[model samples]
Target chain A: MDSMMMGAMTQSMKSMPDMAAMDMSVLQACMDACAACEQACTVCSTQMMDCSPACMNCADMAGTMMRSMLRMQGMTAASMMAMLDACIAMCQTCMDECMQHADHSDACRMCAQACKDCMDACMAVKDMMMASA
Target chain B: MDSMMMGAMTQSMKSMPDMAAMDMSVLQACMDACAACEQACTVCSTQMMDCSPACMNCADMAGTMMRSMLRMQGMTAASMMAMLDACIAMCQTCMDECMQHADHSDACRMCAQACKDCMDACMAVKDMMMASA
Candidate 1:
């Protein structure tokens, strides 16, 4: 996300007690990873391989996860954790599916890497939440 | 989604035993509703009202719900149920928030209606799933 949008989101989040002390840089990195994963999975899905369905699932989950973070007012910490878990599961599924064809498909390789990055980023956010809690 | 994309999704889904008896029309209606809701919510969020965060959350959930339907191979019945419930909850939250400003904002009014339609569509899909199960 751009600084302006991030600023706006931060400003909005200040009103939510659960989100008031959020680490902006960590949140930003996770959002960026989700965006990248969404894009990569979207491109990979177009390849129409067996992994397409998983890629589409991952793309959508990543997008929703990113948006939910931006919309902190709409989320409770438990819901946020559930969403993060779902996203991580989707990313893992997509990564495994894409890895099977990575040797032959550049798109799949990139998508798998993106999913890995997104999963790692999501885990970071989860860790931060746990530490704070 | 367009007919061609729907057809492709249908074709891909044929390989999934759990989705073999799925009703295409019901899924299509739900997807269309989700798409409309996503568009409406996206537009409404730009208004920068207190409801903007809820609108954004609803939009993302609607989009993910739609895409997940298109990629049935990636979803188990349990996960699908969970997602539908989440989508319905999000739509309800967004609609409630938007409805509060419906008397003044045309955008909020439209977004609330879109959310309502999306929630109904999601419920219909859930009903179909339960009946089939």
Candidate 2:
């Protein structure tokens, strides 16, 4: 999520016709959100709450979604859309599961917030892609 | 993962009707392969070759795939199959890219092999699911 990595990713994206026109700022925001969600979910998962499994799933999906954006050359627009949808679904599931325990566990509360942010970010990306298309 | 973590994951899966009859050994082997593939791809990604992006993508996908298996309660059979297919495709892309430089780079060679193993493990899981379905 640093400038240097973003610069490298931007450079890489130039080679893909569908990705060349993407707004770097939007992509960066989504990546940052994904990273934050992944970290939050990871911590939440370690708490061994009932939501742990959903947290684990969301964490991994967020991480993968972030990496896929970083490596756009390995993706087509269709594939990217599918991945974003999956990430969004996973985040929603995790957020719903974590919200149940949010009252008693600070970790779940924070994780749920992270999942919400990530879902919103992913949706923004999807919207951008749709508009561009 | 260690036995304790696996035991916990197995206990968790018992609650999911679709996953109740899963063979833990097969799932364990797939998880091990995914872990190894993730590590190898992470190392290979740092090399900054043409395959670096693909390696990063592969590493994340493999990690996600493994975690999804660990948290089967969050996944349905349809979603799991789609994820497995995506992981296998990512691994194939990474393997193809890494194999290009395998002759000169041990990291690429090992990463390529790891990708192959991960792909095979994912396919085995898919086959198991299909057989049971």
Candidate 3:
């Protein structure tokens, strides 16, 4: 997610037809959101609460989402849409679970925020996909 | 992937409709493969080969595919199939690139093997999904 790596990723993504006309910033934001959400969710999952299962699921999904952005070539329009739907579902579930304990846990609060951000970013990608399609 | 964590994950998974009848062994094997392939792909990515992009991509797709399994609440039959296709595409691309230098690098060979195993495991999941569907 550093500037150099981001630059490298952008340079690589320019080759894709659908992405060629899309803004790199949107992709970058989604990736950043994913990384942040993954970290937050990971920390939260270690809490071992009733919400832990959802947290663990969210953490893994966010990590996967981040990596998918990092490797866009392997993603097609359909896969991307499916992934976005999955991520959104995961973030919603995680956020709801985390919110139950967010009042007592800073990690859960931060995780909820990260999940929200990730959901927003994923929605953005979905919108872009729709527009392009 | 620990016994405790795996146990928790397994217990959570048993609640899913399609997964309720699955041989947990098959899912466990697939998860283990995904974890191993993710690690291998992550390490392989740092090598920055012509394969690096594919490595990075495959690693992410594998991670996503694994996490989706973890978050079964968020996945449907179609999403799972799309994910398997993407993971297979990624591993194929990564293995092809890595094989170019497999004669000189153990990591590449190991990576190729991991990719192969992941692909096989993913295909197994796909086959299972088809049968279940």
Candidate 4:
């Protein structure tokens, strides 16, 4: 995410009662990861692979994470936590599925990496929240 | 989610660390909400309201939520919670924006309703997790 967009997101998050107090950088990274993962997974899913189901799911989860960042008003701390868990789960599942054919397909390899990155970002966000809580 | 699909997802989730022990029914509801909201938001976005940005974001988030449900192996409890938060946040943002036009547009009204339902489902998942923990 660019500084200007981050600024816009920050401005938006300020209205969310529970999110205003947290680190925006962490949130930004997670959102970016989600966006990147979505793109990668979308491209990968188009490929004919047995891992298509996982790719599709990862793409959806990543997209969700990105939009969630775009709109913070609906979130509470509890909901945010649950979302993070789901994203992480989705990524891990996708990564594992993609890994099975990573050697044969570059798309799967890249998608798996994106999923890993997304999982890390989500986990970082989770950790940050937990500390504050 | 059909019993067959849920059964497939359950079998997949067994490999995950924190999710195997969790309730699948709550997860399924959340996933279904995400899917419905995504469809609602996508159709609503074509309406060209000032709420378009919010609608776009909501549509993306709903897609992600749906995908996450399809692939359960990648999830962890923490990530799931965070994702739920993000989805709820996105839906709330879309709902609020769409509510501004609800009186004039049935699509916006329906979109808002979908977002609300999705938020409720996400919160239900979060509450269920907390009880388990």
Clashing pairs in 3: none
For candidate 2, the lDDT comes to 0.87
Q: CAPRI verdict on model 4?
A: acceptable
TM-score of each: 0.77, 0.77, 0.68, 0.63
- Interface Cα RMSD, each model: 2.3, 2.4, 4.4, 4.8
Model 4, A15-89: lDDT tens per residue?
Answer: 757787889989888998999999998998888647776677778767766776676664556656766777787
* Stretches of candidate 2 exceeding 4 Å from the true structure: A1-8, A46-48, A71-82, A102-110, A130-133, B1-9, B46-48, B71-79, B102-110, B130-133
lDDT of each residue in B1-133, candidate 1, tens digit only: 6888889988977887777778988999999999999999999999966888888888888889887887788776666776787788788888988999999999999999999999999999989989988
Q: Return whichever of 1 and 3 wins on TM-score.
A: 1
Q: What interface-residue Cα RMSD does candidate 3 give after superposition?
A: 4.4
Query: What C-alpha lDDT values do all the predictions have?
Result: 0.87, 0.87, 0.78, 0.80
Model 4 iRMSD vs. native = 4.8
Candidate 4: stretches off by over 4 Å: B1-60, B64-133
Those runs of model 1 whose alpha carbons end farther than 4 Å from true positions after fitting are A1-9, A46-48, A71-82, A103-106, A127-133, B1-9, B46-48, B73-82, B130-133
By the DockQ metric, which is better: model 2 or model 3?
2
Lowest-sum lDDT 10-residue window in model 2 chain B: B74-83
lDDT of 1: 0.87
